[model samples]
Target: MPYALYYWPTIQGRGEFVRLALEEAGVPYDDVARGPEPDGGVPAMLALIDGDSVPHPPFAPPFLRAGRLLIGQTATILLFLGDRHGLAPKTESGRLWVHQIQLTLADLVVEAHDTHHPIASSLYYEDQKPEAARRAESFRNERIPKFLGWCETVLERSGGPWLGGRRVTYADLSLFQAVEGLRFAFPKTMKRQERKSPRVVALRDAVAARPRIAAYLASERRIPFNQMGIFRHYPELDP
Candidate 1:
């Protein structure tokens, strides 16, 4: 059966990470929320989420359905897909190491989202402009460099090409997504930040150049960056 991926239609958010992995794995999957009704759409996702038929229920968007198993949490979903698709290492230690990198990218994603919604997700950016500015300023100056620098450090220590040394792990794809979002959310900041993170930037470039990834990125399936998504571009917030 094709993997069923449930996420918001409009926003890439955390779901994009899973999408990238699926795309890279060259596997067929239905982006449930983006499809037509009956078998697809947000209602279908909600049915699975809110319904009691399934033994496991997801708390929010970006869950995956693989046959009998229902997987939630972006990292956990990637872990499953990684093992199934050779997107992670063969050994337990290597797999855990890649998982650790993905979790770290998740941390950076949370920080990036919190920059615009520092006060609360329930509150709009307008409601938290001042707080967002304060948060964004710090993120631009400190967090982005720190997180990206750490990525560069990891890449350097891991030899050359790919985060987990020779293999192309799911974490590599995720790091590319993180950098892509950061570029969209903070283009100006990333311009300077990229100078210090050449390997990180290069990895992002390399990921983009992959045949499937490149096609996926160019296709209509790849949602454009917008204000509503996790990576929103507000001049005030970015300024």
Candidate 2:
């Protein structure tokens, strides 16, 4: 049976991270939430959380359903998929290290999401512009460099090509997504900082060039980044 991925239909959001791994691994899966209601759409996604079919419900979207297993949380899902799809190292320590890297990336994703919804996720961007500006300023100045610099260091330690040494692991895919989101959300800042993180930039490019990943990105299956997604492009906040 093909794996079933449940996430919001419209935006890339956290779901995109899982999608990238599946694509890179050439795994055939059903993007459940993207289908029609009767065939598992938004209602199906909500049912997983609000209904009782799943004994262990996920608190939010981006959960993967594989046979009897239901996995939630972006990092956790990626860790599971990474091991199963050979997108992680063979050693236990290496897998844990990759999972640790993914957790740190998750931290970056949350901070980036907060750039627009700093005060409250319930509030609209227009309602929280001032606070968002402040949050975004700090993110652009401090957080972006810190996270990207750490990724660069990891790549340096790996001695090139991929985060898992010569192999392109899920961590590498997540890092590419992070770079893409950061660039879209903070083009000005990313452009200026890219000079300092050459390895990180190269990794992003390498991931983009992978056969399956490249095809998936070019296909309509890849959702575009928008205001509703985690990485929103607000010109005022970025500047």
Provide the TM-score for each candidate, comma-separated: 0.98, 0.98
* 53-151: candidate 2 lDDT, tens digit per residue: 779999998999988899999888898898888999989988998888988999999999999999999989999999999999999999999999999
Model 1 clashes, total count: 0
Residue 151 CA error for candidate 1 (Å)?
0.1
Provide the overall lDDT of each model, using Cα atoms, as 2-decimal numbers.
Answer: 0.93, 0.92
The number of clashing residue pairs in model 2 is 0
List pairs with backbone clashes in candidate 1. none
Instruction: Give me the overall lDDT of model 2.
Output: 0.92
Reference-based lDDT, residue 231, model 2 = 97
lDDT of 1 by residue, 41-138 (tens): 89998998899776888998889989878999999999999999999999999999999999999999999999999989999989999899999999
